[model samples]
Target: MNAGPISATAAATRAAARQLLRIVIVGHVDHGKSTLVGRLFHDTGSLPDGKFEAIRKMCERRGMPFEWAFLMDAMQAERDQGITIDTAQIWFKTEKRDYTIIDAPGHKEFLKNMITGAAQSDAAVLVIDATEGVQEQSRRHGYLLHLLGVRQIAVAVNKMDAVGYREDVFTKIEAEYRDYLASIGVTPTFVVPVSAREGDNIATRSQAMEWYDGPTVVGALDSFQLPATSVDRPLRFPIQDVYKFDDRRILAGRIESGRLHVGDELMFSPSNNTARVKSIEVWPEPSDSDARPNTVGAGQCIGITLDDQLFVERGEMASHTTNPPVETEVFRAKLFWLGRKPLEKGKIYKMKIGTGEAQVTVQEIEHVLDTTDLSSSTTSKVERNQVGEVVLRSRRMLALDEHTRNGRTGRFVLIDGYDIAGGGIISMEGYADQRQLVTQRAKNITRVQHGVPTDERERQNGHKGGVLWFTGLSGAGKSTLATKLERALFDRGYQTYVLDGDNIRFGLNANLGFSPEERAENIRRVGEVAALFSRAGLLTITAFISPYQSDRERARKAAGEHFHEVYIKADLGTCEERDPKGLYAKARTGEIKDFTGISAPYEAPDTAELIIDTSNLSIDQALEELLGYVEKTFRS
Candidate 1:
């Protein structure tokens, strides 16, 4: 059993190298992520000869005429702007071990970058300037990291040299920051005090701080362990893309499960596609069984080229042979509504889950959460940057996994009109049952129709009949324009029927009114009716103060290209003046509540092909332009 004794430093380095830690360094500008890294290289002798000089020459070429803070920043934007924009991964090693450091930006506008960094990290080393203590962005990053389930955290009290290497100062700052972290359910695992500028305690203990007796920045970082990955849970490799080389087709993916090997049976989910693992191609060489699974798991950058290319696409995920994934029609989610407009219930927005996208509506805002405090609010509407718990009702349910268990299938983003409005993880699941409920509830509703039939309707009319959905405030003259349009179209031999809210309430939609839910249902029913009539090829003109954008979008989906939208745009004051039904008058007097033109909210569409201002467009002119657009729409 006699063996050669290894040196203590060698033993420590081996132990550190074995620990697979994924670290993200996050801090405000000038707080020193790059500087700390720079110091780490210098003190540990990682910097080769002429490397410092190389960076110095680069700085000189850029004409900074001073020491460069962006040498280690790496990114061109980071080098030029002197700020990290997103989380960039860099590998470094000390005599004690290796570290995967993710450098993240601090700018408020770059929250997406921060999200990406936090999402990929196991533990975070938050750099806090000793002079500033904790600021708003610091709090925000901390909160987001906590939400992301980053358990272990390290707080580097940097720039201590500027304050005379004050131990008492750092102690006070640490206590204050810890209390705030506690409020958000996070307790940092380690706090290392160092001056990234002076190189004190970064790689070496500061002789300046005899009062301080704790781990150096290098020791603290070396000690931190990579958070345990969820390999035992389930395999979830999101298919980045499939590749074809000659005759071989490889479904490229990263392993998010128990070790996958050659000839292993695997199944692709959501698509319900399956394929066998011909070989897992990881280069420069595939992982051997002798290596632990932690070395290769979710979030690790490796590609798996399967035996056969099975139509795998980005956003799709692969699972194991036995435990298959479930598909559903609806699911509960915690959404961060980052859209400019408030999230409207029963409005269909495109939801992007992994690679799969579907039309979904906020079925119910169970409760909106206060972003600043993370507390529940009774308010039904959630605005920009507000994170809330929402129950979404989708047109079609996609397969999903609980976010806590799986990151791949669990996360999704919402697209409003053309922009990505929001994104978040799947906090809850089981939407198929809700789909059944929604379908069952719709069965009791009876149908109503306008006189003209399909082929006869379109043949008699020059073009197919469709609803030109016009939405604006009550005074916006939706009905007036609709009536004018009907008269003109009729004169032109187009068999058209104008469906106004006043007339519909008198007949079909009389049961509903201005409450958010009621208004949504009314619009939904009308949108459906209009689509049906248009499909039959008749010119169906419908006008209402359908203030919700989601409702309008749903109407478009229901009608397809046959769906014509007209936003009767007008000023609130002009609309108030033109109030035909005296609805706005009554709302202003507070006699009527939850009114569309008064108390209720309106989400204007980001992209509307036609925008008509009734204040400027006389009934004659508005009708002329609208009919013109509609005439061309069908022809196109």
Candidate 2:
């Protein structure tokens, strides 16, 4: 593409054509969100011409104190407490772009304010405290922005003056925080040093910081080459309202991702819905045919008229014809559980994903991640504001995509009963539970199992095969109790089978080995067979050193509500002394891999009904108590 040398009139027209971009400043409390925004307005002269005088007069009238930040701190309590409680959208202009800057509050308690601001922004200026470095909420805000899919980031390391403007200090903090950002997958475009309160290196270049050399605050702002969404992505129009005025039913919404055009064939994924453009319009008419729809994307308000009445409601999306939308009920999500209570598994919660809302249950918690260090070498229940990957199954399906693939479909908010407590982004499309799909993929291969005549199995023992789970450390005497319990149940007219590790490995589980994942798979297989046994009405007793709580949880879920979970609790010292099989000795000597008793993760279950401590109780005593409970609970 070529253009002739610009005329003065054309250049002036080009300047006038620059659309205002919304930028939001967000960070933890006292981390410079307000001070930075205040400085920007001060530098841009966006405040009244007599700004301090205007503030002074306002304060004088109210008999209150005032500061430069008072220009935007319009709330009485905000001034009184010296903390922002809500997002403030203030308009200002630089030499190049007219801007709307959203100042987001950073207190951990005011995350809603942060979200409100982030929701409206095209880009973000992530503020970090230099002296304190990255705190919990600092990492949290970064993670939230990443979850919200905000791409461009400019990190402002505030309070440089506090640390004596050490370039090394700023450099170190910048590097550390930048590494943190990249872990959650964001690369901040720029890291600028400035003392927001003292105005050093903010609006004006500071000579006091002699070694530091980069764009001054104004320079960075003026030099930013704003990228348009039309050049980057496809058209996306989310229907926000359905309006009918003067017999015209118009679909009104913001062009959230890409440009809209007249006669464009659009498909809405979530509704399994599609539509073709009839007319593209704004309130005022445009002269150019190409600009008739005003050549817009990613922040323009327009009304779309369709060829057919699809009866689309608010929250549905409109995309290009070539790219069909996603329809999904379950997706793998990278979630930050922000509720006061830990994210419990199997409970239903409302998920507001993009424009789609559904009741979603946490199918599984994949891993719990540390926000500060980004370590995920462990898995557990997620606490408040703890980021993790959770697989969710929804009561109702909706259009969806992974966060890496599409920001809109990927983003979701978790609702706890009536409250919106957490939010996250779908990171992966969850696989259909493959066990259920196995036969279909295998040319509809029918499962052919030779039946052991139910009567013969009953003759071999007595009742049905059901799982009797025994959980404890390696040397906890679980096997002894399980052995006795199985014998007791066997004597009581039950078709009983014992699945101890040694017994299992010699036959059905011979192919399995030691590793957390392998052990989990082993437990899973055992649990499955136990269910089959239970279905045949045979009593099954299984004892394994399964260390992971997730594995145990899956075992319980797999085996059904009737499955018995017997926790054989024994102290390490007591178990070591009794080491019947000498397995704990081998494990301690490093002869075993992922040894539960020596080197592995353990998640103790909270609701295990029967806990028999063999350290205090002998094998007979534990078995007596367990069998007694089982008989009392299940025997008719």
Candidate 3:
């Protein structure tokens, strides 16, 4: 019996799927990249019928040489210009694996398009013209490939025919390029010499290069390894959209890392919301033989309905509670700037990563790097196409991981107006803390006390000592109430001290500014001083517009159980009217930066022990009420 004729579609479907590898070809312009890709497709028998003949006929009509590059120059503009202006991806297959070849443009003006191509690739073939040796864009593309985290690379010293296929020419260019790649930590799998135009040593070994012995281009590609699956790592599913189809609200997105199973509880970060997976929904339902239909691994896109209708948006990432990503606003990152304009401090840009977008500012430029030689220079601005280390501060907190730990959540791109201005990887997470340094330094120092015990001092003072931390708007009467209470306690023959905001800034916190990190440090120092006074058996009263809740929590931890948060209640309108020093007017006109209650944020205490509405009450009445409570709590 004879088999019937099979259609092209049927043959393709019947063929078993091979291990997939996405490969990108990059180098300087006119380096025969397209010719190499065309040759690979033709020699591997991956081209369809009449495709090669069509390109050859077109070349003849145009009175041009029969070159394989014409096969890839499918676009009319590219065929006429003889240069790839955009990225072109074509799928081909070898016996061992299926490959997606991404031909990235080498022109300097089209580097952004090249980045888009390289970012999706698992490996790369960096082609260099043997006659040209090494060019400017060759080094740059190499650097970018390393930055994109494409570790598997193979160097193709192309256009070997132009150099007369000399063994020394191949050896010289190979040695120089290899040394440069090593400097940037890229180890090429193989360095092969080939004539892309002549189809020599692409799919099969070439006899023209008798002196050289290495894997052919096809063999080199097969040797490149695929990235390991991240399913064993913690789950990081960034929700793209909430879809409601046929009576179910399904959260839809590709699982970026780790595995997701039915009945597993997940905590969404930055928002800190929890939900349980009800079922893994697929487009085409799986068969009964498919084990665990409610489970999915990394790289799979699926929709899932939760047991609880938890409010989750596109930006919130679903992470396992056991190991969740860090939630922070200020982080240190290493990035390359491709914006036409230089990246300057204080200028805001939009950052987008995974499923989240937020306004971001370059808080500080630590250093600029010379990408060619890996040299560092102290600079305040990152110029066009320059790599730099900077501290990026976002308007809102984001759940992010270190690039080394999870590449999906760690990589981000900066948008300047309409275009993607830059891209980066998170290096470190968290803001600067000089106080932490001081704490680490104090570890070796010994404890010392000069006078009577705290109990004896409190007994003699006729009160139990504690700290009263007054937090509110700048002109909300926190300072006025603290001063009045201090005098009232002193008149009653009790030990008391006031740490006024402006008074302490004049000396102790003189060097600190009003930035978020600086404000935290200022509060940290004041909290320590107030704690020391409390230990000395004196009631310590702190009056400051401590805005952030995190900073206040630090103060509470420092002052122990005796610490009391007193929120002096007053709206922004009332506080601005009572601005005695005319600071509100100055802040409104942009004369003062990071001014709480005017420009910056002022987070009111959520669970304050005391709430005093100073707007309605007179100073004397407010003080009398506060005094009564303090005396009752501390009376001996």
Candidate 4:
């Protein structure tokens, strides 16, 4: 293919409108990643004037073979060491599209830089030495491609000339590497045999290897498909900053995914704040006669002004409320550890995801994978360069989606003091609000055990340590009976405390809401608090309308064996007719959503230590039966 000259204006216009694809070349060190990229650049005629000839002259003057790797090894240190130390990007164009070839360092010492380069790419080209077959870094980089969600990949079995360009040798290496890639859940698009230094099977097919036939490197790159983007998906604009220009406040950011338009309502996650897009603001102010675009889609950097002027800042995501991002403080992630120290449980570290930064702790190490063999290994802490699955607990809730659903929001990086220690993807969401305390046993945090045991405290207090958890629908007389039982236990000279649902909501659970998840969180918080009181050697009476059996079970687990689940039974009709707090009527009128026994589900306990028929039995009779069970259990 021959090329034609172009004016500066035409080139700029072509660059702006051309289909752009980011392609990163990765492999083991001294296996020709830089040479492959340099060869591609030279064959495509993408180099500037006299650049290639200048490198050849430099190589000749230094009494060395005129190597193609010199074009990409631009740094003095990399040239001195004869290795790629950092990721370098160069622009090239095929007949199909424009390309930014990212030459990633294959050396293990620069693995972090390689990760950064691969994360930014849309597709990847993995290189392997044909004679070496498959090295350690080959499997490691392939595993990382799977971890980072780079599905479009092509393998170039380079250095085939060293093995005499034999078809049998290429076939053996290709089969072995294919199996390794499949083990890590990656199916390469093309595995082409090539000698990058000799410029064979790169831009064009090599006549020397006539028996082996496949698309050249350039053909494989062009064959990779481009994904279409539209505004149909949920909006996820991570706020970069809030700019104030001449008294006008605008939120400035690049739409990572989805779309934004004038008058579209957006909800900022973690904060759960809502606002309307008043206008789509852009830079380099248009003339008075010029018209502006009404909407903007993904990858566009634009400033937007909200309908209501409020103090909205960075680190918050702009998303639609109908499809809001999941907000949680805990999630399961797979990360590549690059820290100098092993990642320890309960050790605090700063995590940066999108625009949000928070203190996070490695709560649990599920398992670590040996990247070379793709085998699972048990480890208490994740050492440097090892890929591990872990449970992380952030100090604040973050808005995120699973990587399979949204790559932009699902990814994060851990910063250790001054450097990026690790980077990973969120594979799954977890219950965060109060269930975190349940993992306290697995975390490495210290728990002070005093000289006085709970047995001694209970003996001195004249009662056994336990939590009596009352679960039922609203207006089921759970709170009333719990309070009455507390007084009876107190009068009997027993240590007891009552935790009412509404009372705790005003203090400990003030931030919680009526959503199903929030309600679960509410129950979780009360469960932990009740467990604390029980540990303090008190008979803790918790009266809550915890309608979910799963949540109730978690509460029981958090409170331990001393916890007893008591069902306060009352039919919805009977509770509605009572209307003690006017809650049922409001629930029926649709004034409140997710109201238990009405809008939402109410899961009754299958087995309870005690059941009170509050509908049939009077308040006094119910209190007497509950107090009877409590006294028998605690005072025994």
After superposition, the stretches of candidate 2 with alpha carbons farther than 4 Å from their true spots are: 1-16, 58-66, 182-185, 225-232, 239-254, 260-262, 271-275, 279-315, 377-380, 429-636
Clashes in model 4: which pairs?
Answer: none
Best by TM-score: 4
Candidate 4: list runs displaced more than 4 Å.
1-15, 230-232, 287-292, 429-636
Lowest lDDT 10-residue stretch of candidate 2: 430-439
Alpha-carbon deviation at 134 in model 2, angstroms? 4.0
Cα deviation in Å at residue 408, candidate 2?
3.3
Which of the numbered candidates is closest to the native, going by highest lDDT? 4
lDDT of 1 by residue, 1-636 (tens): 111123545544553546546688887777887788777766776654566777778878878754435546666777777777766665556765566667787766777677777777778888899988877767766777776677788888898988888889999988977887898789988788888878888888889887878788778887777555566667667676767666667666565554555566777656666677655555455366434222355544456656665677775767775765545555667766768788877677898866567788776676776534557786668877566677775665466777776665677888888988877777543222221212333346776775756666555656766678888887787888888888877787776787788777777878876555567667778888888777777688888888766568778898988787788898888978877778788888899886764565555556777899888878778878887886677532
Report the lDDT tens digits of candidate 3 across residue range 224-286: 887776787789999889988788898999899999999999988677777889888886756
Return the number of clashes found in candidate 1: 9
Q: Write the per-residue lDDT of candidate 4 for residues 447-543, one digit (tens) a residue.
A: 7887889878977988888999999988888988998888888988988999999999899999988776688878888888898889898889999
Each prediction's whole-model lDDT (CA) = 0.71, 0.72, 0.84, 0.84
In the order shown, the candidates' Cα RMSDs to the true structure are 12.0, 9.5, 13.7, 13.1
Error of 1 at 546 (Å): 30
C-alpha RMSD of candidate 4: 13.1
> Which residue pairs overlap in candidate 3's backbone?
none
Candidate 4 displacement at residue 524 in angstroms = 7.3
TM-score of each: 0.57, 0.60, 0.69, 0.71
